[model samples]
Target: GEEVAQTPKHLVRGEGQKAKLYCAPIKGHSYVFWYQQVLKNEFKFLISFQNENVFDETGMPKERFSAKCLPNSPCSLEIQATKLEDSAVYFCASSQLGPTSIGYTFGSGTRLTVV
Candidate 1:
């Protein structure tokens, strides 16, 4: 019940298809974090909350990319017209006391494959 939960362990999408992933953080957690691990084993920060900041515009936040951490629902990351470069493992981690807090729970993550 305290662990972060992510749906659809794997996703397959064609280029230009929409890809939407969901992450349910530990209930009552105030902050959520999303990251993308590219093929090179480098992690790219996608977005995070409670302030909801997009770390890198070049990596994401394109017109087709969006993320949200809403109350009463799991946080979501959506990419419209996904490109082949979008294929990566997306991670969602939640914090109890904002980013400053050391305690964070991370989900196993969702693997997205674009062809």
Candidate 2:
């Protein structure tokens, strides 16, 4: 069976520091997605990748967030110059090519806190 994995369930970083979160999508899947859920914000799409190329990144925060999907490696989201507002749960998800209406498989998420 396939599964998504996340590390360090919780993270606390000082303001202006860097925050890195990781995710392993299910094997055989090519589309990986990242999302952020803050205290008041609904789950918002952060980025999407097809294999090693970025498919969509419009939802990524312009100043501080970046993500990548490397070969044989889990995808990662890195936040530079973390801000207090950056505290949230970062989820990594994946989906097969069949249908967009179908839901995706998501990791438990890395809960990040910038203090």
Candidate 3:
């Protein structure tokens, strides 16, 4: 498909459990970003990776959130010991990473529920 692909449309976990989401970028995109939408329409940028390296992750919560982007593999975002506040829709986007990168191609997102 031409669009980014995210797996496991909906995931439910108990508080303190682990949550992992996967994202496959478009074939030629080299930069990937992860966003968290906690409220109805509010989104927060979490992290971004360029190819196999971390590009910027300033928005990631220091302790619980970690992400990876590996060559030939789908990118992933994992939360260690998830908290109730971790419940949200996670969106993945991909871009070419250059002047031509005007915007991102976003995935449908994965809804993560923590109870």
Candidate 4:
């Protein structure tokens, strides 16, 4: 089984502050993805990277949210001017053979709380 490593199990930020999350994809995985879960039934895809290049980011917000997955470095997701509504769990995932070939793994996630 594959595994993605996410750091900072929990984050607490004041309103208007910034929050950042870090993720390490599985050793052999080339595709990395970030998802936001604001509600139990909602999983919003934030961004995806194929190696160091961005693959799909249609679900990403035009501003305030950004992500990067670079070669030889941990991937990161950052949110600027955090709002109370931004409080949620951010999950990092990776697939060894792209999203379609299975072998996908999701990290436990970093729970963010905006106060």
Candidate 5:
């Protein structure tokens, strides 16, 4: 069993500031995912990577947000400009392809606050 690791437990920035979040996918896992949680019961899937390649990104914003999952390097999600509405907890998850009873393993997340 492996676990996804997210760094910088918290982050705070002023409006228009840049925010960068880092994630390390579980070892031996090829898939990485990023999610944004604004409300207690809702999760917005931002992006996903399969072995350094983007697998799905239907929910990601077209502007101001970008992500990278590079081999041998920690994955990163960057927001070029922060906004009040962008304040949320960002979570990283990792999983392998194929059918498995157990699914993704998620990190604790980074709480980003924009003031």
Candidate 6:
């Protein structure tokens, strides 16, 4: 079976620092998506990339958040100047659905803690 891979299942960062999380979508999948889940909250879309191009990213935060999908490398999400409120579980998912549709297969997630 195929799976999405995520690193550092748990991360602890101090306020004002940075946190970088990694995710590898299943092979053969053409689209990758990132999501954020704050304590007991619904998963929030962060960004999406189809192949090497960004498909949609309307949900990304304006400050301190950035994401990328590099060739042959796992997609990454970096949060600079982390804040206590940034504590959350970040998830990565992948799909092959065409435009006009939203579908996904999810990873367990990377938990982030800012103190």
Q: Score every model by TM-score.
A: 0.87, 0.92, 0.95, 0.94, 0.94, 0.92
lDDT of 3 by residue, 1-115 (tens): 6999999899999999999999999999888999999998799999988898998899999798999998889999999999999999999999986423876899999999999
Give the per-residue lDDT of model 2 (tens digit) for 1-115.
Answer: 3878888699999999999999888888788899899965689988898887898999998788888899988788999999999999988888777226365888998999999
lDDT of 6 by residue, 1-115 (tens): 3999999799999999999999998888889989899957688988999988888989988688999998899999999999998999999999878533565788999999999
Clashes of each: 0, 0, 0, 0, 0, 0
**lDDT, candidate 1, 1-115, per-residue tens:** 7999997789999999999999999887778888898765688876677734443345566688888776678889999999998899999898888776788888999999999
Residue 104's lDDT within candidate 6 is: 77
The candidate, 2 or 3, that scores higher on lDDT is 3
Write the residue-wise lDDT of candidate 5 on 1-115 in tens digits: 3778898999999999999999998898888889999998999999988889998888889698999988799999999889999999999988876223267889999999999
Q: For candidate 5, what is the TM-score?
A: 0.94
Q: Which sections of candidate 4 miss by over 4 Å?
A: none
Q: Cα miss at 61, model 4 (Å)?
A: 1.1
Per-residue error (Å), model 3, residue 38: 0.3
Can you write out model 4's per-residue Cα lDDT over 1-115, one digit (the tens) per residue? 3578998999999999989999999898899999999998899998899998999999888589999887889999999999899999999999978766777799999999999
Q: What lDDT is reached at residue 56 by model 3?
A: 89
Candidates' C-alpha lDDT: 0.83, 0.87, 0.92, 0.91, 0.90, 0.89
How many clashes would you count in candidate 1? 0
**Location of the lowest summed lDDT over 10 successive residues in candidate 5:** 95-104
Off by over 4 Å in 3: none
Model 6 scores a TM of 0.92
Q: What's the lDDT for residue 58 in model 2?
A: 92
| Ordering by lDDT | 3, 4, 5, 6, 2, 1
How far out, in Å, is residue 74 in model 1?
0.8
Number of backbone clashes in candidate 2: 0
The superposed Cα distance between candidate 6 and the true structure at residue 29, in angstroms, equals: 0.5
Candidate 1: residue 99 Cα off by (Å): 0.9
- Worst ten in a row by lDDT for model 6: 96-105
